[model samples]
Target: MTHRIALCGDLLDLTADPGWQVDAGPAVRFRPDSCLLIDEAGRVAGVEADAAAVDAWLGSAGQRVDCRGRLVTPGFVDTHVHAPQLDVIASFGTELLDWLNTYTFPAERKFADALEARRGAELFLDALLACGTTSAMVFPTVHKVSAEALFEAGEARGMRLLAGKVLMDRHAPEGLLDDVEQAERDCVDLIERWHGRSRLAYAVTPRFAATSTPEQLQMAGRLCAAYPGVYLQTHVAENRAEVRWMAELFPAARSYLDIYAGHGLVHDRSVFAHGIWLDDADRAVLRDARASIAFCPSSNMFIGSGLFDWGQAEAQGVAVHLGSDVGGGTALSQLRTMADGYKVLALQGQKLTAWKALYAATLGAASQLRLEHEIGSFRPGTLADLVVWDWAQGPVAQRRLEVARDLHERVFAWMTLGDERNVVATWVAGRERYRRPDATAIPQPAR
Candidate 1:
């Protein structure tokens, strides 16, 4: 029922979590400089990149896309983002709570207007693709209009997007809070309309425990328990002050993570951001629940939050995924997030290897979101959503990659220094969405 497509490129084939010892099956490793990905009937049909394999796969009769000398990897999975925060990203520096109150909260308030929300959705997706991200898990504003606009934008772009109507019924500005009854109702409506519709998915978002009342948490817990496929997202151990607020709000809870686990909100499909302040007990809760923590290094440092103990998290078997965290995070580049993550570890007498960073952003994050089977790697039968990266897109990057002999080192150099400029092209579902100034089409950079 769908058009068959094949793509030729230097695929970043991965078969395991870079940080873990698990096999990614046959897809775990990429060949040096070639691979073919075929999409048949809207599902991945074949994968092989040898000249003969590709020629045979094409068979002189399939729609073909080619990547010439660019790094082609699976679409990036941004496990954490506030779509409404796009307008306020890179605002003048302020601390976490103050920054939220000053720029973030105020800007998100405007998303209640559907037109404004839609405009934001368009801009946000454009910005994401311009930087070569094909799919993402995002945080919508507390407004239902926000989720509706974001999902619509993702649909238009043919992306695998997961988002939700952010829930908050207390400890927030008046307009941002949705009463518990209405919050769950909105989430149920979103699921009925968007979840599993094409590649669009729904998330049960509670903003954070601090902003949601007990009833709101219980409602989310019940909904997630009933809908196993729906993702549960919230903030945990992000800031000490926020943790303290949660403790005061839920005195019966043993720990902040306990609050969510006690309510049935913690589960295998859950994704929480900012574990910078998490303790052993919190890590245990996350591990027991099989929940993923989106390690927001840039956001942690940007807000003067304490460094995340990556080694510690891993030792405790907690899944770690990287996110830009946008406004609270200082950079739009997940590559930059890698660099910041390294710096955070370095400060804690630890190190973040290039392989670790790449894994966290790509396959590791995808596993956390439970979308790996469909999109995380250049496997046969996966949608042809890919990015073409210019290893030497700019002078500085060119110089860096020159002496870098290893894949991890080269990727690290590029990550620490590159931005959208390194994005040579971006594709969605076998279609060219952003071409970096070639005969096919021109990418209109986000203004």
Candidate 2:
């Protein structure tokens, strides 16, 4: 039993880094009235522009989805998000430390209940798919059950998910904390069970330097070494106050990122979120180690955290990508993240070009996760995780799109104005996972 799907639309694919300049060689390939052929194994067969070849693909056994008026691109990859923090979104009036106590901790505590964890996981994944995000690196809770539930839900939906049980042995709530020994055992079990299992991976999630004791942080690094290729995710220099607190907490460390480096956690697989207050020295370390920064713009603005310098990070050769940061951030849509990111950069007298922003959300993020070969492109044999989007449904956006003279201009309009509403359908591994109800539906599959 083979299932194939042919998607005909305005296809856009990023082949290489577009850099900051528009004339950086053939970085992006755009094909109008093109057809994407998904093979039986749920991988991309090719993108055909020839009318006869397109007709032949449509005449084959699979279903032909008419996406004539829409845009198709690789599904977005959210570099940082918290699975247990879905209920924490839009909570008002607090900075990072206080907000965590007020909303984030309380919300995550609910995941101690297996049923609650399961329910939250399902809803979180669905919301991500609805926003055209097919892959994400998520934070569950200190409870082993929370990580298990998230992994289970992601597996059922066939989404690419990287998550781990949080390690927090000190500083804050009692119930949410885990002892270093027990946390290690739990992580080993989870890595054995879920890592490398069907589009899933494990990340050693320490809830930042403030939450974890020195012992726990060292143990987290040890686990990364014990299990080669496991990822490391945590926050860093997100707020001025947080940075000051980290300085006091780890007095001997040279800088905020130095604490992680001291513990042997600075590696190519590490993803440090926020990074608003980091200096050139930190950026150099990240670039040298091949580590990445998950630039969470919406969350930074909402929490009143300082702005991250996009140009500075890029100039220093640090890999930077977008993250929703959910509860602290407003929405799961990467489009919204990019919009906020543009403003973040603008405030610092910088520009986030349309191609650069889109590439960061999709291929750039994938490169950070080391999954670029698997997801993030329309290259033959890559997984067909894609999003079909309507350029504009409202009059204001339609007018803007109508007057746009080039691909970059039209995309800039959509990136600023678009939300989940622009997403008409989402496909994970060539199987439709989400479809807008108000939009005309695709025909049934050919059996």
Candidate 3:
């Protein structure tokens, strides 16, 4: 077929968030023996169509790309990441604050040079695509140069991106912190230029309550309010020391979540990272405000911070999105993050199913970014941000699937052990970005 483009194998889409309770529904909607058809316009024509529909779309006038019977999911969305922290993702043991001082500050300072920031942006987005992450709401360093570098890269690649300048004015190293007035100024400038340009979006990012004084957080809120559809991102109660500092800094506020609420930053579009130490009241407030969370399980476990209660949050109706939390998070792959989330929850006597884990990375993340209508599913008219998964990429993955009893069990085993190797090709808006080298694509064993 000359004009064929179809993603075959297991076609999965997350119809619910991770924090959802098991409803009267099938165990997380799985589509097996499926193929997703996409047109040259980058819209999903249909997924798992009947033989005729698949043949018609494929034979229609467009270039052809095939997945060769691998799992195909909507490209993953990363709700939380530090554009500047990509340099130190697995830096050996440093708690949040110390990590910033020892590694983040010096590294971010290099980004003041636009050339350096651009280099990092290319490397960062390339790494994300290799892991099947099509969209992300990322934290740029305090320098406006950092956001510009990322925006240019996204523009070049047709990426559906959300990014911003870090707003900080207090409790941070001098070189890294921005004054309240200047920080808000940079945000407004970036928002004005890039907030809704193409697939690009801007976020009002206040590094955290600790780094941002009351004045800075209020400014961030004003920026979010001014930009109509812009997003707000920040760290909430991620670590014990951070929580104590939040309590001390915002003594007048009710709790850590309350600090952002007081500034109008807690809205339907806000996504707080590392909600590891939340209480019932905290979950209630976040749910009520409709703000979401980017759960950083790998970062939490890597730093020995605290175990996140995924089960409790979902029961309360608070949406939980997934994040790699790079430099802080151990890997750039969302597949790796899903495995980490599953392991941590299991140890706490809670179970994270394959569907729930996938949700955290895809539609669940799109909901947090309020970009669900555009990305994160196999739904017709959604962007063709698709990933072709290779099930038998390695010995172990192939062995597990060979003996798997059920569909969910097969998917569960894949998420638990899969890495970038399982990702055969990643496409964003129907444009192929990364394809594993032929040498890395192992041939099938004799049947």
Model 2's lDDT to the true fold? 0.91
Candidate 3 lDDT over residue span 87-110, tens digit each: 787788689888888988889989
TM-score of every model versus the real structure? 0.92, 0.98, 0.93
User: What lDDT does each candidate get?
Assistant: 0.78, 0.91, 0.81
Name the top TM-score candidate: 2
List model 2 lDDT by residue over 156-267, tens digit each: 9899999999989888687898898999999999999999999999999999999899999989989999998799999999989899999999999999999999999999
Instruction: Provide the lowest-lDDT 10-residue window in model 2.
Output: 438-447
Deviating ranges (above 4 Å) for candidate 1: 1-6, 20-28, 438-447
Name every residue pair that clashes in candidate 3: 4-64, 19-314, 88-327, 89-327
Best by lDDT: 2
Q: After superposition, how far is residue 426 of candidate 1 from its true place, in Å?
A: 1.4
Better of 2 and 3 by TM-score: 2
Model 2 lDDT, residue 245, Cα: 96
lDDT of 3: 0.81
lDDT of 1 at 142: 92
**What is candidate 1's lDDT per residue for 1-447, written digit by digit as tens?**
244455555667566765532322443465546755555555556566566766666565555555556677776777787788876777776777778888999999999999999999998888888877788779879999899999999998898898999988987898888898888788899999999998999989988888888888999999998888999888888888878888898999998888898889989989988878888988988898889888888888878778888889889989988888887886567777878888999998887776667677777777777777777776666777777777666677798899897666676687778777778777777776776664242222111
